[model samples]
Target: MFDFLRDPQWLWWLGAALALGAIEMLTLDFMFLMLAAGALVAMVAAALGLNLTGQFVLFCLSALVLLFFVRPVLRRRLEESTPLAVTNAAALTGRDALVAEPVTELAGTVKLHGEIWSARPQWDGETFAVGERVRIARIDGATARIERLPA
Candidate 1:
C-alpha cells in the first residue's frame, strides 16, 4: 500500500490538485484554481520521472505564470459578464416619494419606496404639504433631499 508513495509521486500531486480545485469552488477567486493547475503540472513532471527539485521548480513557474497572466484576464472577463446592481441610497435616487409630514427646507418626513425617511426640501424656502408627491434629489447622511413635483 505505502510502497506506491515511494515511487509514484504523481499520485500525491494529483491528490493535491484535486483538493485545491475543491477549495477553489468555495472561494470563487480563481487563486486556488491556478495553484491546482500548478499541481497538475507537477503531476506531469512526476509522470515524466523528473527529480523532486525539477518538479518543484516547474510547479512554481507554472503557478507564477498562471497567476500573473491568466488570472487577471479571467477576473476581468468575469466582471464584464456580471451585471452591475445598485442598492441602498443609490437605488433611491430619481425615485418618487410621498410626503408623510409637511416638509420644509430644514426637516420633515416622507414615505420613500415604502420606508419612512427623514427628508428636507431641495432648495431654500421650499416646502411640501402632506400627501404631496416629490422627487428625491439626493441623500445626505440619513436625510433625503426632495423636490416637489410640478403641479
Candidate 2:
C-alpha cells in the first residue's frame, strides 16, 4: 500500500523534470527543457533499479549531449522557418518623407520617420520645395531617393 515510501528516487526525479518543464514554459530559452530531458533519463535509470551514481551519470551525459548537440539544430531550424523582418533603410522604402530643405537634382535634406536625412530627387530635372511632402523611392547608402507625392 505504501511502496513509494520504500523507493521514491524515481518519483523525485520525475518531480524535478516536471518543475524544469514548467520553468521552460516561462523562459522559452530551451535550457530548462534540456535539463528536463536529462532528469527523465535519470528517472528511467532509477526505475530500472540502477544505483544512484549510475542514474546521475546518465542524467549528466544526456543533459550535455542534448544541450550541445540538439539545441543548436533546434534553434537553427526555428530561425530558418521564420521569414526575416524588414528594418532600417529597407523598411523606409515607399514610406513618406518631408523635405526639410529645398531638394534639387544634386542634393537636399528631408525629415523621414522623425529623423533628418540627406535626400535627392529621383529625376535630375525635378525639384522639391521646403516642407514639400514626398515619397521615398528607396535608400541609397546614407541618402534617401525621393519622388513627388500625388496631387
Candidate 3:
C-alpha cells in the first residue's frame, strides 16, 4: 500500500479523482467532489516526485481548504431554498386546488397536484366551497395552507 504511494504515475490518481467527481455530479453532493480534488492534488504531487508524506500532506491540505472554505461560499451562491415545481408533487404548493372533501370547520383536506393535502383556510372567517378554486398560501412540511381566491 505504502510502496504504491511512492510511484510517480498520475494516471491512477487522476482517474480516481475524475470518477469521484462524475459520481458527485450525478448525486449533486459536494463532499465527494472535494475528496476527488484532494486526490487530484495528491496525484499531481506524486507525479512531481514528492515523497509519500508530502503527497499525503498536500492531499489533506487541499481537501480541508475545499471543504471548509470553498464549499460554504459555493453553497451560499448556489443554494435554492424552494426549488421550482418540476414534479407534480411539488406543484401543489402554489397552485389552485379544489376542496375535494368538505372541511366543515377550520381544518380540512384539498386535492392538488393529483394528491390530497391537509389544508386550512388562511382566514378564520373565510369558507371554501367544494370544488372551488383556492390558492395555496404556503406549504409547511406536509400541510398546504389555503385561502379562497377571487375570480
Model 2 lDDT at residue 110: 98
lDDT of 1 by residue, 10-126 (tens): 988999999999999999999999999999999988887898899999999999999999999999999999999988888888899999999987779999979999999989898
Model 1 steric clash total: 0
lDDT of 1 at 71: 98
**Cα lDDT tens digits for candidate 3, 33-106:** 89899999999888877877887888899999999998887777667664555764456556888898665446
Pairs in steric clash, model 3: none
* Candidate 3 backbone clash number: 0
Residue 114's lDDT within candidate 2 is 95
Query: All candidates' lDDT scores?
Result: 0.92, 0.92, 0.79
RMSD of each: 3.4, 4.2, 6.1
lDDT for residue 19 in candidate 1, whole number 0-100? 100
lDDT of 3: 0.79
TM-scores, all candidates, are 0.81, 0.64, 0.56
